[model samples]
Target: MTTPQDLLIIAMDVTSSRDIGQGDLSLALAGAELVDLIEAGALTLDDDRIVPGAAWTLDDALLSEAVSSLVRQEPYESVEDWLWRRGRDLFAAYRAAVEAQTPVAAGRRRWNPLRGGPAERADSPARRRAEDRWSKGDPVLVGLAAAVGIEHPDGEGAAPADEAVGTVLDAVHDAETELEAVRQRRSIENAAFDNIWRAP
Candidate 1:
């Protein structure tokens, strides 16, 4: 089954023309993965950092790896730090999951001189499912779409402003803000976080 992280990545492809940066997309997928874990009862927020719970033993290898890395980190990084640290790998994993649905070129689009057009990632059917779910107010999809600044899926022309979705979006925003704050604190700190945040 396509996970929430897969849907979020696919949504980025459907909604944005410009490439979503690695860091940005990674963080977003991290947030989505976190929410997915929570929904599955595998993880929870303890002081705003993800902590593994009953569902930590996920069948999905990518999520299992993410949880395992979170478990091994020191000083108990906040959701933002965890996401920032794990962004690339999480994004890559989710990208693979999404691409597995409809195989496509790796990374983003490229100019194909012979075809005289851009090489594109395959359009994922999972994205359509997510969009349909979002229109029906699937909180996970709504929350993720909101986090990525996509248009509300409801077609009523407004993203959910409800407290639950608000809370999820807030967590995502907090992660991003925390990363930015760390970036501004010092160059070495930024470099350090960048280097060691991701799981090996």
Candidate 2:
């Protein structure tokens, strides 16, 4: 099965009309990777920190590598930091995977002004279905679309889309907020300790 991150790349390719901005797409891909890890039970978000979870036995190579990297890092890492460092590479990986499966005719490389370089855009029945699944409220798709700023309706009637979007926005906001607080507290604590060390 194609992972949520893969599907998201396809959706963006089809919907962006060859004008996908690299910055936001990278951010979305990075966020999707984290979401994928969380779903696989390999990692969990505790406020601003990403905590290692149970061993992941998944066969997905990319996700497995991500989990390994996370585990090898210090006890915890901030979500924003991870995303900033890894988003572009993850987005590139997704783009490569899509092009490998899709024919050159259906998925074409063209100049993307937003990217300031060549970019791939894919159009196929599978891509269409990916979008449809998102609109129908496949939870992963919905969350990913929301995370990446894609406009996919929840389709559960009037309130569902709003609620679903709200949920994702809240999660991202809360994570960033908590991580910032942690950084601030640590900075203060380190400064006080530094004073003690200097006193001697």
Candidate 3:
């Protein structure tokens, strides 16, 4: 039986085919349930499940939706040439990588407000108040906290104005494209392998 702990979720919602809309993917942490989702066809595995010779196929939009629901992470998508050169099985690695990006960095400064942007912590004692968690006494601690905040731009918190979710999904989509292509090519290869392995 598949358990939630064994699998992960890639939740994403892109408005259209052109843009990389914001999304989250947190379901994969519990691999077993995730595997169950995949087995039941409720959630499609990025490249691995999307490929030929697999149990099912997911369209681009649906793929985006799958990417938006769970914890969001930067998926491991290799360049087209790179994937072809590596002879990887599918986009499973990339999808898994991206899905895994979260929790791994959960407590890190990466999730702080103003991700990848300037710090609200450094602007004197008053300014840092609204931004930092380590703002209790100790001038050195405050300074250190400010430094940390400035370095890790927590996009959602730093600039809530920007469409951060969409940006995340777009990245997922881009990675999936290469995985999808590789999947198709692998289909051809798989057929050959099957024919050879099961030869009369």
Candidate 4:
């Protein structure tokens, strides 16, 4: 499975006190897609700008779409610009894509006293691969997961070896931090508005 798909699966499987924000997840997913594209030689980073390589035919439909959406003109998009533009509602897109691929049960099951209901997700190779990567502390995966608030048990993983991938990861972290700041400002503004209305 693709990194974006694996990330979405992990986010869904995780249980955290603070809910994962879709905006943060979307930015991270965009970063993951860029990392995979760089690994595949589909694109390269000229400084912080993304430079598209020769036309590529990706096997994954969503990835192919990502390639198609690249800003091919001169002075290509910066990593931060790409994150905000392409990442818009990206979490919902990945969620829908994953849900469409998952199999649905046709028959209803009888209630059981001892055993729990069917598992949320069937045991699958994709999930196994994701879990393995997560457990092994794959740097890129770990970095992307952390951007979305998924902490590693043994602390943060090492930084990515590739400079370009590291650039993307850094952009993801900055974007997530900026999003969080926006949330805090909104929360404070909302609280102020409530206090004003409640004042005698």
Query: Which candidate tops lDDT?
Result: 4
lDDT of residue 9 for candidate 2: 47
Query: Which segments of model 1 are wrong by more than 4 Å?
Result: 17-19, 54-56, 72-75, 104-128, 153-168, 177-200
* Tens digits of per-residue lDDT for model 4, 1-200: 89998887776565433557678788999999999999999999999999999887899988999999999998999999999999998888887775555432245342221233322665567777887888898898888888877787866779989999999999999999999999999999999999999999
In model 3, which runs have C-alpha deviations exceeding 4 angstroms?
Answer: 1-161, 197-200
Model 4, backbone clash pairs (residues 3+ apart or across chains), number: 0
lDDT of candidate 2?
0.57
| TM-score (C-alpha, index-matched) for candidate 2 | 0.60
Count of backbone clashes, every candidate in sequence: 3, 0, 46, 0
Higher-ranked by TM-score: 2 or 4: 4
> Model 1 TM-score?
0.63
Clashing pairs in 4: none
Model 1 lDDT tens row, 24-75: 5567777776666666777666666566664346787777776677663445
lDDT by residue for model 2 over 1-200, one digit each (tens)? 35444555445443432334454556556666676676666776666577887666568677777777784455677777776666655666666665555434545664332544334545565565665665566655554554434445433223334332334334544443454567679999999999999995
Off by over 4 Å in 4: 101-119
User: What TM-score fits each model?
Assistant: 0.63, 0.60, 0.22, 0.88
Instruction: Kindly report which residue stretches of model 2 are placed more than 4 angstroms away from their true locations once superposed.
Output: 2-4, 13-19, 54-57, 71-75, 104-129, 153-200
